[model samples]
Target chain A: MKVANEQTTRDRIIETARQLFLTRGFAGTGIAAILKEAGVRSGSLYYFFKSKDELLVAVLDQYKGLLRPILIDPVEAATNDPIGRVFALLESYRGFLLETGCRMGCPIGNLALEISDTHDEARDRVRENFDAWCACVEGWLVDAGDRLPNDLDRAELARFVLTVMEGAQMQAKANKKIKAYEASITQLRHYFEMLESRAK
Target chain B: MKVANEQTTRDRIIETARQLFLTRGFAGTGIAAILKEAGVRSGSLYYFFKSKDELLVAVLDQYKGLLRPILIDPVEAATNDPIGRVFALLESYRGFLLETGCRMGCPIGNLALEISDTHDEARDRVRENFDAWCACVEGWLVDAGDRLPNDLDRAELARFVLTVMEGAQMQAKANKKIKAYEASITQLRHYFEMLESRAK
Candidate 1:
């Protein structure tokens, strides 16, 4: 009973922090704000997370886990054809962005933008997340049977795909237009098909 | 002489505010901090702008003006070949990101991420700045002759290019690797050339 209840409090603290962090961000969110929102006392908050930074990392880990299915699964499923898969990945992003009214810009992108200069650990985690994501992208390209530019390499293509999605999401969010994302993915698909044809 | 001094104070306040806003963000930055950095009093800050939001708009306008030549010039000059010009634009961006050490993200992107649901005016300005940038991209595609996909319009192509670049910048900033931006632009360029060949 003790372990179960302890776990519940910890989880509760983490969930509250995650929501506040996403809505407010690292530098902008205060512990008092989070404590008030969570209906937890300061002692309880400190019991779960020793510091705000630690709490943030937990928030990011939770966020990453939640976002994977929504962001990566659809693209990964299109593994049979890398080009189509890339487009599908982008479309999945579009669907999410449109659904959310273009709010909650890419979480990784958001953290990176906020913490890269100040927090080395948080910054590195953001980089690792992006690299892991790129590795997934590279897998899609490799499965495509080397149709992409040999000179270009999978790492480069991964960067390209990642860039388009992040940029499109921001633009779409800013403009409140699904078309911005559609435009990016459309060009990306066309770009990929071109390389595939050239290789053939 | 009085007008000149007044203009100097206003410019100083704006310049200081711009740096703080980019580094600390909208909510993270306070009027007191801006005044301190500008070496002015609270009363002086209020004299120039009615509120922080007004000051923010001014800062953004200033940023847009500053970015035009540095960000847009090379892309425009690369106009000799529309497809080539677009690639050049991406390359210029890579150079810009590397120079910044991937710390300060796209100012517009930063604002969009930080503003949340408030400051619709600031959000709209960011959108217009993005659209202006995209317009430059579309103009390049227009110059590409029949290189772009016939089915898709220039506006669509431009929007895609914008997303890729923005996304690439965001990812590269997160990863702290110049290579991330390079990979994205190269693939996008390859995609553009493929479209040209298909048109032939």
Candidate 2:
């Protein structure tokens, strides 16, 4: 019973830290804030995470684990067409921006840029998060098969999709408007149509 | 002579802060660090700018002023082909990644993502920077004229280019490799070719 309780406390700390890091950024957020919000004492917080960096790793791990359930599954459920699934995935991001009034973007992308210069371990984890997300999208493009050109590099295209999503989210959040996000998607759709036309 | 010396001190402070912000990020950098690096005292730092936020505005404005000369002129001088100029502009960014070993990406993009959530004035300035960049690229696409589809939305395509650059920079910085940057540009080139092939 004590072990289970400890596990719950750890989970709560991770969850609270993740939200704070997402909304306020890793640099902008303070450990005191996380402790207060999670209702955990300093000893417990330190017991689970020796430092804020470790907490960041946990948050990123959670993001990696949750990518399928929180991000991919809903979009996949909405569409079975492999090519359509790609856009469905993007549409989910668009939905996030609308829901959040463009206040939040991809938490991983935000951290990827913010901490890449300062932290090595955290940077590697951020790269892993990006790689995992890219791999999921790559799987969809592979499932797309000959609907895309035989010469098409699925990995590169998958990376491109990731790029567009991150870039679009940056623009949307900065401008406090969804139009920037939509414009990128519009162009991406055009690119996809062009590729599909060339398919044998 | 006194007025000129004061302007020199102000310029020195902005330049130092700009470099520090680029490398350490806005939140990561401190005012004391900027003053020390610029060889200015706290009094002098405050004499020109009231706060760190005000200093950031000055750095951003300096970036705005430098874009045409520091970014566009050299690329424009090298390539009269409008499309080629776009790639040349991207090449400049590639050079930055290679030179810094992927430690630095786009200055505006770095600030755009880092400051968007926390500072309204800075966020608006960042958006303006993006707008100015997009407008420059849009002009190139417009110059391409009959080389692209008449029905093409130049503005949207320009925005797409910005998205790719920012996204590519994010990946490059995260992975600590130039390959990610190269991959996005390769795909962007493919997209450009597809558009050009449709030209009348």
Candidate 3:
């Protein structure tokens, strides 16, 4: 019972910090805010996390763990078509923007831009999250087989998808308009169509 | 003499704040630090700018002033071919990453993700800077003429390019490696090739 209760407390702290970091930003968010929001004592938070930075890392770890469930699986279930899944994934982001009024951006993209220059451990974890995302896209591209040019460097193309998505989201959030996001995704779709037509 | 000197002091302060904001981030950087770095007193700094947010808007406006000479003109000087100019601009960023070991990502991108949720004025400024950048790229695409599909949406394509560049830079900066950035650029190039071939 004690172990179960302890694990729940830690997870609650990590989850609260994660949402706050995404919404409030890493630097803008304070340890006190997390404790207040989570309804946990500072003693419990400090016992689980050595400092605010450690809590951020814990939040990042949770993101890593949640990617497939939060990001990939829904899109995967929606479409088994490999290339289709790519766009489906983007469409989901579109819905996310709709719900948030284009705020909160991609958690990793936001965090990466915010702290990649200064934080070492957090930066590596952020990169790993990004690389793992690219890997998922790469897997879809691999499944794409001859639909894409045999010579196509799927790995790099995967990176491009990520680039467009993050860029689109950032611009959309900044402008508080969905048009920028849609415009970028439309262009990416056209690029894919061009590639697919060429392969034929 | 007093007027000219004051203008110099204000410019110096904006420049210092811009660099520090890029390196240490907006939230992490303090007024005292900006004062120290710019070698100006609190009264002097506040006399010119009301608050840190106000100072950031000034820095962003300065980026607007510098965009042509700093980003577009150099690449234009390198290549007469319109399409080539696009890639040249990306190459310049690659060089920037090489120099900084991918430490500081795109200034607007970092700011957009960092403050888009919280700061209304700053977010607008960031988006305007982004739109200005996309317009420059759109102008180049328009110049490319029959090389790309006439059916192509030049404006959205420009947005896509911005997305890719910002996204690629963010990833490269996060990982402190140029490969991710290079990979993304390569994919964009290939996408352009496919479009050109289709036009042919």
Best by lDDT: 2
Candidate 2: CAPRI quality band? high
Question: A148, model 2: CA deviation in Å?
Answer: 0.4
Candidate 2 residue-wise lDDT at A133: 90
lDDT by residue (B1-200, candidate 3, tens digit) is 37535668888999999999888889989999999998999998889888888998999899989899999998998899999999999888888889888986688887888878888888888988998999999999999999999999999899889999998999898888998898888889988998998899
lDDT of 1 by residue, B17-92 (tens): 9899877777778888988888999988898799999998898888778766877775666557767777777777
lDDT of 3 at B91: 89
Selected candidate, larger TM-score, 2 vs 3: 2
Model 1 chain A, TM-score vs. native: 0.85
> The CA-based lDDT of model 3 is what?
0.90
10 residues in a row with least lDDT, candidate 2 chain A:
A1-10
Number of backbone collisions per candidate = 4, 0, 0
DockQ of each: 0.66, 0.89, 0.88
> What's the TM for model 3?
0.97
TM-score of candidate 1 on Cα atoms, chains taken together: 0.88
**Arrange candidates by TM-score, highest first: which order?**
2, 3, 1
Residues A74-126, model 3: lDDT tens digits: 99998999999999999988998899988856889889988887789999999
